[model samples]
Target: MTELLDIFRALADPTRLRIIALLREMELAIGELAAVLDQSQPRVSRHVRILVDAGIVERRREGSWVFLRITRDGAVGDTIARAGEWPYAPREALVIAHDARRLAAVRTERAAVAERYFAEHAPQWDAIRSRHVAESEVEAAMLAMMHNRRLGHLLDIGTGTGRMAEIFAPTARRVTALDRSPEMLRIARAKLSGQGLPVDLIQGDFLDLPMAGASIDSVVIHQALHFAQEPDRVIAEASRVLRGGGHLLVVDFAPHEDEDLRALAAHARLGFSDAQIRGWFASAGLLLENTETLEGGTLAVKLWLGRRRSDEDQPPVTQEGQGQRKRLAA
Candidate 1:
């Protein structure tokens, strides 16, 4: 009863209601909310705090910017989620319509900034792409591999420019795009907004993911593992978060003699080999299910599909199982 009253109190204000409406459309920063509301930043933050304390809003920080969205959990969140369906008074309707127009302007501003960043970084990305098979071909192959699988909770590690998250969001129950670079996440936020799916952009390291164990149903490390100083640790961390039978798809370069990439692109490793990847998978208790190789230009890209071994997939912990394990170790 107290919680219900707190929720009602949070929504009792006009500005708070407007903020909720805007968030329902897409995630917005406090500054964006202020711009839409024609209020000062401090005032908007106070309203945000009220909603957050009521469990009606959530705040996610990526770099210096904090993004706000409607919370999609619990009974209060579900009830407030239906605010979009509630009939508003004539004045409320007009105000919402006006806010929607301002929201469009905010979206335009975000797009312009994102475009500038892309233009500045396009050459480096283009150089790498020029050396690999066409991105379309790579994406097609990935789709075919994941076509029949359920992408329950998809995590895209090192989600540079959010391409993988954007590509897989439609099929995923929830998508989390994580990157170490805040600039890249900003660019990704611009790319993944309003995709009609719940996409969360997080600033995090792949070697130590900020997720609980066995929480993810699928993971995609797309063309990003070569940047890792310890790719094996990255694989191990990914496996830790995967549920039983969950999938991990790694798309990266096959072993190559590209020394220039090391200096020019900040690549920690030149490329990877089949034996190295298979060994890493086995060490992490994952089974390598299938492999696809795409060759073009000077570099070749390989996709290794691995599945986490469930208890059912493992031998029972019996005397026989111990002997089998001993033999495998030998």
Candidate 2:
């Protein structure tokens, strides 16, 4: 009763209520929230702390940035949604309209920044992705490859844009989408948020996962390893997390002499050869199940499917146990 009352009390504040309304648009940093609320970060953070304590919001740290988003898919979220529908007084309506304008401005700024980034990088992305067989075909291959197999606690490393997670979320028991960039995670959160599947958007490195050892049932590294400073270490870490009998899927370009990629896209390793990746898999205690290559203009994408050799494995949790970001505060 006390905890429930605490939640109601937290929302009783007009500022806090407004904060929830803004979060429904997208996750924001304290500074961003300050801008949207037209308040100092300190004051905004005080309200943020109260909401977090009341389970009305979630806070996560990505390097130096702290992001706040609504608490989704739960009783608290349902109650908040109902509250959001309350009839607004004249003052409340005026304040909300003003807040909405400020929020739109913030989103515009964010989109502009993202646009600049994509403008500089889109050519590089399209160049590499273009050569690859169409994305739909690759996705179909991935789906067929995992046909009829269990996808439990699936982890998508370097889940840029969270597309792979979205594709596999329907079948997987739970999906943990991990990435290093705060900006990318923000985009991913918007796409994955409010979905039926249990998806966790975590901002972290692919080489050093935040999950416990042997915690995931399946791992997907799609078009991400080529950027790794140390791809071997990445696979090794993936090995560390996979429970025995769990599956591993690596989708990347085959060995290529795309020297231009290094300068344009920051690709550390050009591409991986079958022998090189297979060696890494052997060292990681994963047995290669099959390798399929799809042809493209000048590149070939290889999919390596492997299974942990050890018979004993640990189950993480049911899909529902994964998370309820869908109900995050609206």
Candidate 3:
């Protein structure tokens, strides 16, 4: 009964209810939570304590940071279920508005922190971060996408180290690699330039690409979707630049249980499920061709191959374009 009372007390406050909603997607650290709640760390921590005691929230330690997630059981869940039985109240709007403002403030602060981290670490990112999946598989996935295409022009979004570009440059007439980090771009340019490849490097956010609509034949995003602030927007941008029947290949880590990524990267969501990816593609007016899951020792990679649709009632990627000619023979 005490637990139930504690849960009711926690939910009585609008701020705590907002916190619960945020935790539904991913676990977050106290500092990160505070940033999202637009409250002091101590205040967020205090609220979390009540929730924890009520058995509505659970905490786990990852490295030095403690992360919190919604607890399935205990007092809070029961209170929430009970609350649902009540008729709609006029005051619900007021509570929702108050919580929305607080949550917005928290999100704004978290974005600032994330931008600072990305800026500071941009230069040394390649050396500082180790690859969890095999480099060879990454190359193979890119190559597979280029296997049938004419490779007139290719765009690689978030082209860290130019791995995807390196594979595409051999077969592609022109390769444009876009990234936000000048330091990472430097390494990518050095590597691709050394190999005598014709690759153009651009430093920009993937969400706001500088390319025109229907300009590129193929677009590849490798292991970088998890870092996006607005992945759905990025997908739309990718679709916008691709010509009809052009392919978009995305390779990224499978979603797993990781609280640190949620906090540090401000990941709106984790590794995407096929259904989610398909929905995004459909929304963006693209047709899904295939999806492959590649399992590595430490991480799982999901590869999705999708193609832009044409206005005419022609089947996607007709036989003429499906010429079995391998383009990577430079």
Candidate 4:
């Protein structure tokens, strides 16, 4: 079939193959891919066009930048995905090793740039983030908590760097990442451009989300509430967009005496307590479904799960796996 032949043709080029390999590591923007390949933007774009036309790669647009990644859903994407798994010939292995080294250098530069960005930003991110357990641990727990629920369109409120969007992409049919800062959104656009997930980045106010009422299936507020002047108002605005039966996941610091965070970090509030957040959800017509806390060296992080009422006439949705509350705060 012509379709099959197109795929073979796309893979025939060495540059295209290398691009596929690089994408397996993480999503990359067109500029990032060009840098990694040491090729011109126009030249790389042509190769990308070939793979994209063959349904082997996907492109996502965020602001002025475009990001690329190998497709992950279709048959051709599966075939391309197995390229790294297949044993390579001795000569081919050498080429791959060389590419791997180039990738390492590229990653080093990215890490350095990220470090500089964090250092320049206010709110001593390292100091605050250090208080909690590793991010990977918190993310894993979030996934576990969401395992039993039906996954749908997910809205990530204050998607600082698009990490939650990346993590929830596989389960969510679509993801809308909203942030107020254009600079942060720009960085997030580059970081989350690829992998074929339908992503939308918006620079807007959390107090009034630019969306229709009852349109979203799930809303996530990841470590962004303490920055808000009115955290409860933000929750109410989030609930306004929830489709009946949608869930809300809130992650933030539990109440703390970190006065330094208020001045040095630009924190509007020190932290939030369970009683306070739960009451906010109740006021917004959401019922508390689950609550878990993961204590860190200095500050304790909390995860609150709530569900919007489906209908007053309809029976309440019974959430399974609602075991004893996880109380790890110390």
lDDT winner: 1
lDDT tens digits by residue: candidate 2, 1-330: 987898889989999988988887667789988998889999999999999998989998977888888886576778766766778898998888898888777777766665677787787788877776899889999999988877999999999878999999999988999999977877676556545556778887888899898999999999999999889899999989999888999999999997988887788988899998889999998888989999977889889998887845345556675555444543
Q: How high is the CA lDDT of each candidate model? A: 0.92, 0.85, 0.73, 0.83
The worst-scoring run of ten residues by lDDT in candidate 2 lies at 321-330
lDDT per residue as tens, model 4, 52-77: 99998888665575767677776886
Rank candidates by TM-score, best first: 1, 2, 4, 3
Candidate 1 lDDT over residue span 1-330, tens digit each: 998899999999889999989998888899999999999999999999999999999998888989888878888778877897988999999999999999988888888999999898889889988999999999999999999899999999999989999889888899999999988988887777756657888889999999999999999999899999899999999999999999999999999998989877999988899999999999998999999999999999999999999988965599988899899999
By the TM-score metric, which is better: model 3 or model 4?
4
- Compute each candidate's TM-score over C-alphas: 0.95, 0.76, 0.54, 0.62
Which sequence of candidate numbers ranks them by lDDT, best first?
1, 2, 4, 3
- After superposition, candidate 1 runs with Cα above 4 Å error: 316-330
lDDT of 3 by residue, 253-318 (tens): 677765555666555567888987899898888899888887765457788888898776375775
Clashing pairs in 3: 35-106, 36-106
Assess candidate 3 and give its TM-score to the true structure.
Answer: 0.54
Clashes of each: 0, 8, 2, 1
Model 2 clashing residue pairs (backbone):
70-329, 71-327, 71-328, 71-329, 72-327, 72-328, 73-327, 73-328
Error of 4 at 159 (Å): 0.6
Q: Which lDDT value does model 4 have at 108?
A: 68
